[model samples]
Target chain A: MRKKANPFFYLFLVVFVFFVMFPFLWMLLSSIKPLSELFGDKAFTPFSSHPTFQSYVSVFVDYPFMRYLWNSAVVSTITTVYTVIVASFAAYAIARLQFKGKTFILGIVLSVSMFPQIATISPIYIFLKNIGLTNSYLGLIIPYTTFALPLSIWLLVTFYRKIPGDLEEAAKMDGATLMQTYWKVIMPLAVPGMFTTAILVFIAAWNEFLFALTINTDTNYKTVPVGIAMFQGQFTIPWGEISAATVVVTVPLVIMVLIFQRRIVSGLTSGSVKE
Target chain B: MKNSGMEGQAGVELNKQDARLPVKKAPKRERQKKESRAALYLVAPAMILIFIVAVWPVLQSFYYSLFDLRLSDPKKSEVHLKYSVDLGRYLDNYPFLISSIDSEIKKGNDAAELQDIKEKLQSLDEKLQKDPKVKSQYNAVNDKLMNFKQPSEDIRFADVEKSTAEEFSKTTESVSSQLNKAAKKTEFTQEKKLLGLASGMKDSIIKPTFIGLKHYKEDLTEPRMWRALGNTLTFTVISVAAELVLGLAIALLINKAFFGRGLIRASILIPWAIPTAVSAMMWSFLYDGQNGIVAKLFESVGIVDKMSNLLTTSTGAMFSVIFTDVWKTTPYMSLLLLAGLQTIPSSLYEAASIDGAGKWKQFTNVTLPLLKSSILVALLFRTLDAFRVFDLIYVLTGGGPANSTETISILAYKVMFSQTNFGEGSALSVIVFLCVAVISMLFIKFLGRDLLNDGNGAGR
Candidate 1:
């Protein structure tokens, strides 16, 4: 039988949980409360509001939120698709191909991962303006690919290298070109890395704010983060509308993670801090 | 498995190309050459894209810094000019001609030529106010005029860099006086200042040039640059310290098996997974002071009976940001340390227990040293990240309650973007890059080989 828990651990656990969970719970609470109850001196509770979907209703009816959601989905999905595809083929090349400058390419890709996105933001902004990519989905897609590629390529390379070359050599000896060898032999083994790269890229694409904020000026194509951030208009802070929008935006990721926690954790750990 | 030889590791030791020697076994020379070409072709997509997307923009940013182009423009006069400069660069470009002049003033060799250029420039400025093209050119010229002059040793040559920084705040200070005030500051009247001004002026006669030691020289002189460095140092120390202590506490608590352990674990990851900007925005809303939970908690805890907000005052605002950052990021630190904790192989604990070691003894002797690499990893990442934190502060406070929370990154953004001072921004970016590189180098050198090899012995 489990004995009484360490009091020290228990006390610390309570404080930790309170600190972590308080904001989320408060978000839920504040979302329901009507404007009047939210403003009052008394402490607010999740159920304090008049139990209304009025905030949710207003968010959809009032703003082009659905359009924003669509735009975000379109851009992030395109980014994920390109990152995975490009990173996979390229990763396959680096890991398997004994091509010239192979190590040089790997080191350059690795260094690119560490370069601060902020330093390059101004230059990219100017370049995009020249190419007429600014204020467009293509603008976001191109840069997002750039941002996501290094991580995608790194993760894929790690996993690809983990696979044995014997599998590909067998295919190669059996009358396969290197392209066919990669597609037929090694690609199937790299499923885990591919999925991991796709999901992480999706997350990065969804989470990107700086580019979405500055590059895109119009509301028609705003991402969820930018949309909710600039939600405040001419007069009052639309707390209700903004909160509802956040809940809607956050729900998909929360659900996706809850359903696929194993994959995401493996993806995140390997794709970032570890091999 | 002999990766040391087969795996691709380039020799950085050789600055030039490595001399390739022939290997004994080759399947077919003709086929091998074709395959090599194919391999280059295969990797070409990623290589080209990486170049276009990643390195190209930086090259573009550097090149743009050389010319003068302000985005707040509508255009034409060869599209841009090099006449505009900034204080730091002017200070950098000392013995440089013509610091701060009227928008109408243009660069010339002597005072008489300078006056003629000034008249022509003034006429251009008035026209610019009306014409979009002229206005764009005018703003470009104006920025150059206000920022060009540097302090020189000779009496006639010294053009005080007047403060145009507060000009957007001040309506009365014309571009010319701004230059004078900056030039007149005899505070930098030292030998190093004279040399820096002289060297910087000569480096670029037309555009701003680097005085090799000007940035360093200004580090001793300029208050704003020094303030930014101080801010970066302060932010790094406080944030990392708080994160470490708090993260360790949480990791220890969660290490013990408990009810709702899985739920709590997942719940903790929630904060980490939520994007930094989103979390910052969420805290900003909750920290809305007038109706914030922070105010409510303060009242509830008996700290302040009057339910006051924490963001209205400068210190309070700073605390509010720190508190939110700690709450959100401590999980990342814990996760890493927890990973390290897992690697400890509880057999050590079992052995300690058998030896009759106490819990404190086991933790101190058994766990602490074992946990070193991961702790360093966590510390390195957090410290570097904290030093350059931009998004969180940008979202929450915009570096305010009077610039109290402005870190180096935010200060760089303002100088580079908001003020359109490319030279200063470029200098700032280079400094930030160096600082990050230095930290990484220190971590690698001191933390042993963990920087390159992840603790898990996979690659080897």
Candidate 2:
């Protein structure tokens, strides 16, 4: 038997939800509104009198928006793939194998992951310069994989440890080699964990600003975040185009994150929460 | 029987390592050793990658902080061991300048002044001839200049002593300044050319720039660095505290069974899920003085007297950034706390209620104590993150309206990239790392003791 809530409770919920949703809603509405109406001192309503797709169209026509999207996509995809592969191997060894210094290695990974990116920039920049990797996709991919590995390993290790030991024992009893059991049984069970790690890694690489800003100087190689920030006009900032670009870059990520909301939440909280 | 069997097993295990009569146990041990080797192989790629990517760079950053590396100055672009002369640059300008000076003196216009300049040039050239290596390189470079060939970098550069470099630079400066004054009065054909060439020679002297810890000393004394750090600390402390309170409330609110809980949870996560850069840009518009609805709303609420004041004033910009950060991250904070909340049994709440504990009493006695570890973990992560903040504050205020909002990370970036001062930038980066390490140590040493102690006590 559910009891009726107080009126103030409903009011609080309504206000809280509205406050949470306002920025996104504002971004959407502002993206569609004509430039003239977007800045006017009108009541804060959801719609404008003259709505247009002019800003969205201009983002493509007047800028290298598509190129930035491609660069971001390629970088993020490669980063996710590399991070997942490297993290899985290390995580599997950590979770199951009776190896010496396993605890020490995990501790190192955790501490390094906490290191501020600023500390690593100058050396990485110089190192990449020495190796001729600067302004290249491989440049961004390597560091992204390096930084993402610790978290990916941590999350995957948590999941891998939760698997039943009997399952692996059964695989061994059925004439399976150690590699064969890992490939067939463990891989299948760990797929969801890998998927979650991949999504988070992709999102992280996609949104990364500092390295992307520093590593790629050529506009041809710049990622979305840097590209959008560098968008310029002769005398004025074209706010409409910027807002449209933000919407373009952000909406797909928002949709994807919402779609995979449960997996993301679980992946994020699993390591930190000590059950 | 059990004790005897265990002792027998232990005796066999102890003797197994003696390798005398334990052939049957050897295969299992061999397999275990092979597995350990395999694990090492499995972990090698990641370890090497991490070293190259993460560990190596930090070490490299520390190395770079010792030098005075500035990309804008060609001489300081790379580390130098000895004071070197760009024989190529010297040859390119020296011969032409001498010929021009000779021609102007021959023209009999400003003869005395031109002769003085020529004598200064000759003395420096004679100084150059004193060193055997410099003389040989100078001759070879002079030959190249005669041939109108681009001097090869290897053959065209030679090291000079500190005194020679200083004397040569001083002479070049006086000669150029004198020529500059003479060129105004003389209508000689090559007087202007002589002045330009002399000044170019001054730039070719590369100094040994291995200034160990000078940048660190300079930055430590610089007030701008301290101000940026203070701003970062202020933002971290205030924003994190706000997020904690709001996150705890939201966690409590959502922890209870309610209608539309899933929708509320999903909607709240949308803020956290958006890319920080995009959200920062979005907030930039909302904080825009001219047309931002959020700014207008703030004005209406009397938070500020003017709509434009939010991002344009020092206090308002800091407040706006912190508010935006709280808006974006409270959901994440709540989610972490909710995970902690889930672990608390409802029986504890029921028992508290039976003990005449009201809601606030239950919250203090039950929720707060149980949530300590979770709160600590959340605070640790958020504090480190908030401390290293760059993109949001970067995009929003741009550390601006007078750089009042610039954090240490943004300051490092501006110094390193925008100004191309890599040495000082690296020092700032090391400082940030030190600060982060200290914060992590504090959390682990103090709060982590309780978190770990409770686990051990409970497990036993």
Candidate 3:
């Protein structure tokens, strides 16, 4: 049986959760407030006298936010799919096969993940410009996959290592080919790991800013993060529209976190803790 | 009798099987080879993509650091191997300038000065056309100029000897400046055209600008780069240190079986889960000078004299950014520590209690010692990330309030993209990479050694 928690523990927990959730709560409240209430003299009021969806409507109407959302979806979805497929192949090789230079390859992935994106920005911009690939979905997707590969492969490798070797051995004994064994036996069990990797990579791609800002100058190709950042009016910022945009982009991610909290936690720790 | 006979027959069969073992081993070796090849095949796609997307770009950036590349100037936009001429540019303006000079002389005003300038220009043009290839290209360019058609880039440029390029550039510059001065003494119909065309021709004398190490030298001497780096260091150190302490406390609290543990754990991830850019925008609102809740709280609590001070003052801006970063990332730090906490056996705390040790004593002896590696890992990740902070500062402040919050990454972005100075920008990028490499090296050398020592201790 667990020991009874101390009274101070509850007090500390309350403070901790309050600190953690305060900004989010503030953002939510700001999003629903009408402009007059938001910028009024008594803006410090906890809630608006009248709650409205005007900011949300204005976000979609004032800018091409729907287009930006579509762009982010297209780029992020493709990046997630490609990153998973590519990382899975390599992760399987490293985890299951005995190969030369495996340690060297793993080291490369680790070091590359630590590479600062700023270092590669200029060259990648010049390269994409030369090849006429800038402002296109492929341009952003390529770098996103490169940056996400190392983490995706690392997490999947740990996951692959924990599966019983006997399963694959049994499949091979039953006259299954290598592809058949992986597809029919190994992959079915690795779905949870793959889902975790996909979610992490999708969030990364959706949230990446430097590349999105550098690669696409056209308004039509801007992702939500870049587009939202570029929301400036003549004299001051449109905080209402920005807050609405933030809520729109962030709610989906929060929902994903709610649905896959355990998987995300495991994936994060496995990649970092070296267990 | 039957068993003895079967044994003798089995002995003969065993001898035959042993003789065929070499043949079977050869196929096994080949199978192993095939498997290795398959492994290579499986990893090839990812490896090749990484080389293209990650490795090649770094190499390209390194290559660009060796030149004086600026996109604003036409001559310096691309790398030049040798002295070359924009013959079309020269021809487009040189002939018109000569005719305008002819008209000036025809007006019989400052005829001697005009004649001297015309002779110099004619000689420079002749020197440029001295090379046979250049002569051919020059004639083609003149024809295109006469026809009022723009010359293609390939046909407009031709390589020249270094001496010829120097001589032509000097002559054109001298002539252009002289024409400007001479025009001051006269009021002629073609004075404006003459000066305009002459100045235009001065830029047409393309000279090679391959200044290796110049960008690096400038960046190394510039105070702004160092200041940006100092700001980054300040942010990294303070924010990481704060997160470490707070994260440990949270990890200790949650390590025990608590009611609603799952809900608390998930809620903690909300700040970390939000995109950094989005959260930065949220903080910008919370730190807004006019109507920010945090600013109001700070003002009311006497943290600042005014609400706008949080973002408008340099120290306050730094404090605000670091505090926001700590708030967003402490959960991540706590989560990592929580994983470490779970690994520590409950028996240690129980044993401590049996020995009559207090909570603080038990933490110092058991928890801190065991949690070192996790703390090291978390610090390393956060340090590297905070050092390379770009999106947060970029969106929230644009490194504003006189660039008090600018980091090296923001400076590099401003140089490379906004100012379009790729050479200096690439040098800054290389500097940032070197700093990061040093930081990682220091972490691995020190922290990794501790981890090793702990492993050996455990083994003993």
DockQ numbers for every candidate? 0.35, 0.45, 0.48
Off by over 4 Å in 3: A1-4, A172-177, B1-28, B98-123, B130-132, B139-147, B177-189, B351-357, B447-460
- What TM-score fits each model? 0.73, 0.87, 0.90
Model 1 chain B poorest ten-residue lDDT run: B152-161
User: What shift in Å separates residue A210 of candidate 1 from its native position after superposition?
Assistant: 1.5
lDDT of 1: 0.65
Q: Pick the TM-score winner.
A: 3
The collision pairs in model 2 are none
lDDT of each: 0.65, 0.83, 0.83
| lDDT minimum window of 10 residues, candidate 3 chain B | B451-460
Pick by DockQ: 2 or 3, better one:
3
- Candidate 1's residue-wise lDDT over A189-212, tens digit each? 889779877887888898888778
Candidate 1's C-alpha runs over 4 A off are A1-15, A42-46, A96-104, A164-166, A169-177, A271-275, B1-39, B66-69, B73-221, B256-261, B299-309, B352-357, B447-460
lDDT (10s digit) by residue, model 1, range B309-415 = 46666667777778888888888777777667766777889999899999899889998888877788778768877877777888888887677777667776786
Q: Write the per-residue lDDT of candidate 3 for residues B253-328, one digit (tens) a residue.
A: 7887878777787887778887788888888999999989999999999988999999999899988999999999
Q: Docking category for candidate 1?
A: acceptable
lDDT for each residue of candidate 2 in A1-275, tens digit (9 for 90 to 100):
22255667667788998998888778778788888776566525668788899999999988888988999899999988888898899888877776788777787777788899999998888778879988989888877865788878877887776665556655654657778988999999999999998888887888898888889888778899888877746676677888789888767876786688888888878766766
